[model samples]
Target chain A: MIEVRGISKRYGNLQAVDNLSITIEKGHIFGLLGPNGAGKSTTISMMCGLINPDQGQVLLNGNAPGIKETKHKIGLIPQSIALYEELTALDNLSFFADLYNLPASQKAERMEWSLAFVGLQDRAKDAVQDFSGGMKRRLNLAASLLHDPEFIFMDEPTAGVDPQSRNKLFESVFELKALGKTIIYTTHYMEEAEKLCDRVGVVDKGQLLALGTVDELIEQYGGESRVHIKSEQGEESFMTANPVNDLMTRLKGLTTVENLSLQRPNLETVFLNLTGKQLRD
Target chain B: MMKAVVALMKKDLKLLFKDKMAVFFTFIFPLLFAFFFGSIFSSSGGSQGLKIAVSDRDQTEKSQAFIGQLKEASEFRVTETDEANAKKLVRTGKQVAFIILPEGFGENYGGIFSGQPPEILVGIDPARKAEAGYLEGSLMKLGIKRFELAFSDANEMIKQLDFSIEDIQQSDDMPAEWKSLLGDYLPKFKELTELEIAKQPEGSDSSGLSFGSDGDNPMMPLKITKEEITVQKTGPRNSFSITIPQGVIWAIMGCVIGFAISLVREKTLGTLDRLAIAPISRTQILAGKALGCFAAQAMVVTLLFTIAYFMLGVRFDLIKLVLAVLAAGICFVGFMMFFASITKTEQSVAGMTNAFLIIMGMIGGAMIPLFAMPGWMQSISHISPVKWAILAFEGAIWRDFTYIEMMTPLTILTAIGVVTFFIGTRMLKLKQS
Candidate 1:
């Protein structure tokens, strides 16, 4: 279990993370969604204990995030490559495993298991310098898992990764969740959040704007989805505010409208409608 | 805590080995310096030769003898030249000294020995003053010998004059035998003086009276020898050997600079932030980093030792040599750690550390030997870590100190390392803000 309360972080005069509160139960994937510079990374950094919140406290199972005894209970995967590039995959895994205070006798086993989990067992002997971007990302993820922590904080874990690698990351997150682990995942990709998160928190300008399931958010801000019709020769044109029933009636009435499509707003539209801004910038 | 420390050490080792340029600079370059410096320092031409010039003014048997003495000295090269040429040669740095013998030098003491000091002017170039001084001393000794022989011959000539007994007894200042001789020889002396004065009619008044007024006969047969002996010192004792060892100190300083870069790299790559979140205290992380750096530098020092032994013959007892190297390692590691904690960027760290190393080398005896430096400068060198490190190494090798004799330098080195380590760790702890 992870709990953050009234967390606020100030970088000089700018509030990077405003006073906010959230809780993540065990065995669930919680998504932290935001646009660029929305304090998503700041909040995750605080959760990972890499930064001290100016006016709040974070607890891991009722203990401080980085308390000596509680440190082994959580794992952190940063946005950047954190493993030593010169070290082989096996070497990198073994080092992180040792950091968890794993016994010497168990380190080899843990390293092998972690590498196998990331599907990098064959490339374990090769240096990380030779690994592809996705492979390195997988290895970075594996480094965090070596300690087998109960809860993990991942900051844009799929950013810049290939689709295949991203899918693998999602599968791994689910696998960890299935094993009764808790995950706090931060990302700008709405589809990833919609697919993986049991619940999502939408943050912007260092403040939480909304928090609920994808369906719940759609119901709150969702309006009548419409379909548009157009003709090449300007013979006919039409707009249907209620697309479900009106689509068939309009198509039946307008035989000249050759190109017609329904526009059910995706997450990008949902974000724009709610915030009156593009999701990307 | 121990686990995290090990993890940090392992990570640093991995990164260092991965960097080919870093490996080359930290390990290979120092060996090159050691071989190069050692070969020059241990060369056989410690004090090879000296340049000397001989001014043969008298052109007599005695002058030829003095020139021959200079020529026979293998260490000195005697050049035959006159006073004008000798002075120009010494001034132009072609010769270290010139021996000048004045005119009529051999004839001034033909009869009675009157201790008329033969003045041989030895002109020495100030740049080669010591070498010239050595030659001057040798020439003075030879001149004395020749003058004594001339005096002996003059004594025999006085005996042959044979003065009247009444005139010799009547001379108040004359001893009994010399009085009898002077009384008998007064007319001969007067005749001899007149003849000696007549030989120089143009300037006889000035020359003869100067001799006569000093109670000395100018007719004495004396041999004047002139030899311009210039001594020029040559070999590794010259400028090159002195200047390059100072460069070796800078090379050692480069090791510290390299380690500081490692810290900056850690910061840039976000490894430092990652380590901070691990279950380790800041002090432990700093300790791990410093120890890893010390180990790397110590390995380099060992490589330098081997190179010096095989190529430069820098001899030392293995135990004492290792001890001295250990002391240097401690000081360098501490210095780099402290430097790294204060600096934020790789460029800053590199620039600052290199400048610091050079400054330390300059202040320390590594760049300038303490004996050659001014008093205040020597006192200021004590604060530089390289000063203690160089002193420790030279003490063991050049001073031939036993292990017990190395207490001061070793203690000072350890103390500095400890204090720097403490301060650096404190800085690291405050970095979380």
Candidate 2:
């Protein structure tokens, strides 16, 4: 388990990550969702030991984040495609594997497994610059696994990837979770978080506004499901607690209805309600 | 720790070479720079002419006069010493060469018609044997002027005539009849020389006897015999030998700039964050960067010097040259680190590296020869590692540096490397904090 206790970070006069805290369990996919300038990257950086927090501390399994043993146990997949573009996928993995100081007997095996896990086994010999955006993202993901890190911090892994590549990345995240590896995924896309996160944290202005399971947060902050009826005369919408049962009763009185649909509260509605719809820098 | 550092270094080198322009600048550009500048400096002796030592065994009026003429001429920088120390100066590479006038040089200063001409003995450093030819040519020019004066001066004319007559009388090589006739006619010529002197008013016009008004031949020539000797190994035989080092420094600075920019690139591109999060300490990351730069610089130095040895007729002491390259590599790596530390972006680094290196090269004699710079600039050049690097190279290659002499540049360069490295790493840590 990884625990961040009241961690805060400041840059100049700006509080990039305010006094905030979150705990992630072992073998869980925890999603962190925030708008731009919401301190997601800063929080992740502090948790991964890339930067020090101005206050409080982070502990990886009851030890400091950057301790010799603790650091080797965790891995970071930075938001950017951090793999070396000039090198082949295999070479990139080989380099990271060396940095991890993997045992000689297991080095090649782990390299092969990491590439295979990303579905890039055959493309290992190709330069990363030649890889598509999705392939690059996948390769980026593979680079972090050479040491078989227990805790993986992936920040905005699917920001600009196509739907197909995003699916591959999601599949890989699922596989990692199945293998009982803890994952902290940060993203701007609410749907990606909705699909991948076992528990999601919505933050704004360096503060966690809401935190719960996907359905639980939605039910709490996502108000009023609605049903829309399009009739020959006009269109109408009715608010209800239960759209399925209420729409059935309302539709029986509508003889001229041409189309009917139920609108249910979801994560986006919950997110907007908790963080507001204001634009962020 | 070593494994992580090595991995980082290998990765850096791979990426650096993968960029074609970086390879070109790192390996090829310096050679072109050296060649172009070498061509310019090859024929030039700089603001100062070639330094030469002179010893007059004849302490007579004409010898004094000849030495005076040498001092006035701009072609040779004259250093007058006794014959006892002339060879020592040349052997120790103090002066380019030394010229010695024999005991009878004054009496036989110029006697084209009076038999053997006065001889000037030249001792030149063997490593710089080509300079002997230059010294000889310069001496001949000074000799011709004295030869003209010898014929116009009445006393010099009488002396030459008498010496010729005495030579005929003493000659066993001359036939009896020819000897008698020449011996008889030489005195009459001597009488005419005195009468001609009587016709002249004073020392205002000392123009020598003229056969014709222009381009006339009144033969009075000085014989120059060159002897090459030195303790130094083969050195700069030509201009290219000197310029090869100039070229090498450009490439070295190029590597420095290239690596510095890459360091900033890592930060800007977010790669540094990944490395920072790794288990290895910050020291190892910096070491890896330094090693990558050193490797690039070493490859460049080796390839360039090998080309110089085979293609440019340059020779050097291998041990000293290795020391020089190592010191230079360390020094420039510090420059690389310092550059990386000061800048935050690729554009800024590129600008800083170019401006900084160009200034160092200018003042250091890497672009302009130190001999060509003003005295003030030369004095300032000591602060530039570029100058020290070149100085170390010169000591190892052509300068015939004693072990003690080699220590100056090597020590200074190493010191610069260590100091700058500390500052650079310290700055990095401060920024991280």
Candidate 3:
């Protein structure tokens, strides 16, 4: 568990991370969403112990962030592929393993397990310099796992990776959650946050504007459900006429229609409504 | 902590070795420089092969002997010719200095030794006064010795004449001996026509020195070969050898520029921030990077030493050489780290480091020999690490100084390394902020 209390980070006169406070429970996947310049990255940096907050403290497992003991238990996969491109996937994992002070006897086994978990077992020997963007992303994930960290901070791990690799990353995240590891995931991709997060925090201008499960967010920021109507009549007539009334009456007769939701607003709509702009700048 | 540092070091090593151009400039170029410069400067007397032209108008045994002596002297390549040919060569700049001997010099000398005074003329170009003067002076000194010998003979001949006069009187004063000496001495005495004239004045006219004609010192030749020696011989002189200091300077510069670029690249790639977030301390990250650079510099220094050894026979005391190299390597690492800390891009570092290197080389006497520089300029060279490294290398190998002699330079170099390293660490705070 982590607790951030009155956290603030100021850059000149702009508050990148305002007086923000939040609590994260163990084994839960948390998502932080915001538009550009929303201070999501700054807050993530503080959480990873890379940057210190100006006016507050972050406690992890009842200990402050950046404490050597606490840092040892956390793994960070930055937005960029921090893996050494000149080294092999295995070598990259081994490097991080050594950083965690893993004993020589267990380093190889742990590195191998991490590679397999990312489904990059066959490409472990190849240098990261030769790997594709998605492959490098997987390797980045593997690097974070070599330490078997209790808490993981992933900053848009799937930003540049293809859907196939994204799915592979999601599977790994699931596996980590099963292992009871807590995760703080930051991304601008709304669908990813919607599908993977157990709870989401929507931040804007360095402040947490909204926080809860995806369903709760959709309810709070109400948006009409998307309805697709099909009729045997000409498309122009259906478009011109009020088909919504007839469709609603007929759809109410079917069990699927009766129980159907009026597109309980996708994360993108919720994000746009909250920040008044696109998820990506 | 140790394990993490090692991992970072290994990663940095991989990066450096992968870049062939970096490896070449960082290590190979320095060695090539050392080898080239060392061999050229490592001659026995530090003579840098100078050209000299001699005009043998006398064509006499004495003049030929003098020319022979000139040829055997250190650093001279002598060519003999007539006055016209010598002048032509000098005008063409084929010769640095030219020497001229007058005709009838030997004939005059023979007469002078027999009691007649003789004169010889030598002409020299004023344009080459500095270089040509030294040779002229030595030649004149030789002529003076010969003149003294001739004078002594004349005095002895006159004394014999006095003894012969006394021999004729035979008054227990050895008068018969005096007459016999005087009878033999008068012919020789009558043979003495004039004082010997040597070395013509340096203008177009052959207005030779007239020793007997002038109311001046009789012993002084009417025309004395006046030579002046300039430019003292002290240290090595040659492009190959003189470039040692420049090479050291360039190597340090290369490191500063190279690592700064690496730092900027890592920053652009976002590797540095990522590394900072890792559990390892910042010092370890810096150490790993610096040591990696040191490893590269070591290879360069070693290559330079090997080439210099084989090409120029520049021998070094192994232990002192190693110590000097170690000190230089440390300094290079420190300098590069400092460069990396301050810059935001590799281009900036390369440009700034190159400029800094040129200034250092210029001030440190790397581009020019310190011996040729003014004292104030040489004193100013102390600010450059290259100067200190060059001093250490010269002391260890060129000067062949003992361990004690190398102590100061080595200490100074190490001190610079330590101090710069501390500054580098302090500068790294910018990254965090």
Predicted complexes: DockQ each: 0.54, 0.47, 0.49
Candidate with the greatest TM-score versus the true structure: 1
- How accurate locally is residue B403 in candidate 3, as Cα lDDT from 0 to 100? 83
Q: What is the lDDT of residue B299 in candidate 2?
A: 88
Model 3 lDDT per residue over B187-217, tens place = 5543452223223333422122233555343
Off by over 4 Å in 2: A278-281, B36-235
TM-score, one value per model: 0.79, 0.76, 0.76
**Candidate 2 C-alpha error for residue B361, in Å:** 0.9
Q: What fraction of the true interface does each of the listed models get right, in terms of native contacts kept?
A: 0.63, 0.70, 0.58
CAPRI grade of model 1: medium
Candidate 1: lDDT over CA atoms?
0.73
Candidate 3: CAPRI quality band: acceptable
DockQ winner among the candidates? 1
Least accurate 10 contiguous residues by lDDT in model 1 chain B: B203-212
* Cα error of candidate 3 at position B243, Å: 7.1
The positional error of residue A56 in candidate 1, measured at the CA in angstroms, is 1.5
The numbered model that scores best in lDDT is 2
Quality of candidate 1 docking, DockQ: 0.54
**Candidate 3 stretches greater than 4 Å from native:** A226-264, B43-88, B97-129, B138-265, B294-330, B365-372, B398-407
